[model samples]
Target: MTALDTEVAQSVGDIRESYLAQVGRRRLYSGLALLIFVVLMVSGFNIADERNAGGFWEGLHQIGDYPGEVLTEAWQKRADLPGLISEFFPALVETVNIAAVSTIIGAVGGLILSLLGTRGLAKWPRLIPLFRRVSDILRAVPEIVIALVLIFILGGGPVPAMIAIALHTAGALAKMFSEVAENADLKPVQGLASTGATWTQRMMLGVLPQVAPNYVSYTLLRFEINIRASAILGFVGAGGLGYELRNAMAWGPGRFDEAAAIFILLFSTIVFFDQVSSRYRNRLTEGQAQ
Candidate 1:
């Protein structure tokens, strides 16, 4: 080969080797990162298990024991099951109401926060960062913490749980809503402004129409989650099926049937909502696509 051709061939071979070396280094780094992540996860799990009231292996066999006992007692007193469900129906209603009210309140609050925080949609663009920080603080605080604190102050009832869940929902939904708002078309907003529309008018007529479906989908999903949270808060004296369940457990062996009834009610309610929410969410997304 000519000298220039030979030189070009050598240069290409060097470049190919360098590229392979870089790929090998990246693979090595990725492997190391994955290994470290696995190690941390395993160690964290071990530490948590050590601190738990029951050991994992010891508890594994007994996991089915309580359910089996509950089932046996429930089956023997099957005739009374419907009556028990009827008795506790009001508590179930209270739980659902708490979830529904909280979801509505939170959705409204979140909508305001989202509009305030989102770029190009904010009423006051300069205060966008402040609104975002407020949302962050709200989201960071757990629902249980707020519920427990409110329980101490307001006395244990559905109100405390409802407020707690609403606060959390507002923060959580704020972030999601802001993300949706950020992508909203600004042309309608500009057109409305040209007609001397106020901020509320622009948002209600221009922005909300575009994002309403997704917002409703998110709110429905939140309602499902809030139902569970309200029930759990009830265990801590908020007054719902969980309160009844706690009472039944406190009564020991004789009240296993009552506990079983509560279990069935809670499980059925959760499953029903899950199915309904999933169906509605699917329809909303499909509608949005069309």
Candidate 2:
């Protein structure tokens, strides 16, 4: 080959080798990361199993035992199932109400927090970080922790659960609402501002109109989540279907029928809400896209 051709060929070969080496290094790093993740997962599972009240292997086969007993008892007392459900219907209504009220209050609080935290939308730009930190702290606290503490002070009732769920919902929704607000078209806000509109007016007329669909969708999903949370809080003396379930469970074998009724009610309610929320969310998103 000519000298020039030979030089070019050498350069090309070196480039190809370097590229291959880089690719090999990337693959090696990726494999190492995957290995570490697997190790951590296995170790975490083993640790959790060790600390559990029943060993994983020992309880694995018996996982169906409780459900089986419940089902058998429920079948034997099938005639009483409707009566049991009716008796606990009030508790179910309380759970629903708690979720509903909490969602409404939380959504409103979150709307304010999101507006205050978002850049370009904040009524007080200097307080954005403070608002964000407050939201983070709220989201970090568990609903059960808040519920139990409130119950101690207020006595057992649905109010504590409602407030606990609302606080958590507000914090959780604030981050999401702020993200949506950040992407909102600023033209409307600017136009409104030129008309001597206040921050509240601009937000309500300009920003909220644009983000309402997504906000409502998120609120509905949160409502579904709050229902389950309220029920759980009830188990800790907050008072709801969970309280009824706890009472039934404490009665042992004879009360399996009652437990089964509560389980069916809870499961049915969850599924119903999930389906309704999913349908509405789909419609909202589709409408927004249009």
Candidate 3:
């Protein structure tokens, strides 16, 4: 080979070596990460098993016992199922109402937080980190923890559950909304700005229109989640179907029929909302694609 050809060949060899080195490093990092993940999982499971009241392995075999008992009792009391459902229907409605109210409030709060935290759309760019951290804190806290605290202060009711779910929903939705908002086209915002529109005006007229479908879709999903959360909160004294379920279960074998009815109502409501939300989300996704 000529000198020039040798130089080019050497450069090619260097590039190939560098690429192989990078790939080797990536593989090493990935292996370490997998090892750490496995360690954490094993250790966490062991710790939980040790601390769990009934022990994980011991309880594992008996997990189906309660369900079997509930089912048997429910079947024997089949005639009372209709009456029990009717009696608990109002509580079910209360649970749904709590979810609905929380979702609306949360959606509105999430929109504001998303706008303020998103990089390009922020009203005060310098405060982006602040808003983001606030969202993070809200999302990081469990709904049950918040509900318990609020129940203590608010004296137990749908109100505590509603507030707890709303706070968590706002934070969760803000993260999703910010992601969607980040992808929004800036041209509309710029146009509005040039026309002397205020920040709120630009957001409402320009950015919001673009992200509204996604926002609504997220809200619907949150609503479904909040329904379950509200029910759970009810068990902790926030009155609703969950509270009724808790009371029924507390009464033991004799009240399994009541528990069964509440379970059925909760499950049916969840399935119904899931279907409704999924349909709307699919439509929104299709519209966005168009």
Candidate 4:
């Protein structure tokens, strides 16, 4: 065959391969869609089954029958909105306290771990395996499990929750901080070392400055998460809005309304924090850009 004919055949073969790849991609997407639909269908059936399992119809009827009473009680409390919020405010404050303390404690621990975590600062390559293994072990433990254990040991209050959050946060941020350290520009740290800067001096002027914004950013994010976590810890007897929520739910009738109010407060708190944190993050990003 002529060289021109050979080239045409090769071009046609390439086009055919591309067409097959596109067709395979479409089938893959279709299969994924089908899998998602099946999962939704199964989940729906399970929910329906649970709803109908007991004398659920009667329970629904009871709620429906007394809808007016529920509304009336909730409405009556409108005049006491300030009092209720005030009562719940302490728990909210406790949650904030827990979150703040946890973040601070976690960041300090992470900072210490980061020194070893940073590959650039690492002296012995043999130490890398030990640090990696330790970090891996730390990250493997979930915050919730830590809370459960602390609940058993400490037996109650925001202390257990705070410790739980701090431990997990330390574990998590240590890994992230280490990665940041490993990837950091080593020039400044190395140069500082070459100039006879003490380890602390080098970290303060060189490494710390480079990673400060990121470390602070992560700490802020952890505080936000800790707020939500403090709520769950409340279920296990940690003092927070979650405690109020638990009491309300368990106390029956008018209590759910109180719990719902607390939920509103908690959600608003989160929204406020989110706005503040987002603004700070944006400012930091802008500063970096400039």
Q: Cα lDDT of all candidates, in order?
A: 0.93, 0.95, 0.95, 0.79
Between 1 and 2, whose TM-score is larger?
Answer: 2
lDDT of 4 by residue, 48-77 (tens): 868775655546667654455545666777
Over 4 Å off, model 2: none
lDDT of 4: 0.79
- Those runs of model 4 whose alpha carbons end farther than 4 Å from true positions after fitting are 1-3, 6-72, 123-125
Residue-level lDDT of model 2, residues 38-71, one tens digit each, is 9999999999998999999999999999999999
* Cα deviation of 235, candidate 3, in Å: 1.1
Model 4, residue 114: what's the lDDT?
67
Q: Backbone clashes per model, in order?
A: 0, 0, 0, 0
TM-score sort, best first = 2, 1, 3, 4
The model with the greatest TM-score is 2
Give lDDT tens digits, candidate 1, residues 1-290: 69999899999999999999999999999999999999999999899999999999899999999989998999999999999999999999999999999999999999999999999999999999999999998899988899999989999889999999899999999999999999999999999999999999999999999999999999999999989988998898888888899999998888899999999999999999999999999999999999
Model 3, 1-290: lDDT tens digits are 69999999999999999999999999999999999999999999999888888888788899999999999999999999999999999999999999999999999999999999999899999999999999999999999999999888889899989999999999999999999999999999999999999999999999988989989999998998999999999998999999999999999999999999999999999999999999999999899999
Candidate 4 is scored at a TM of 0.81
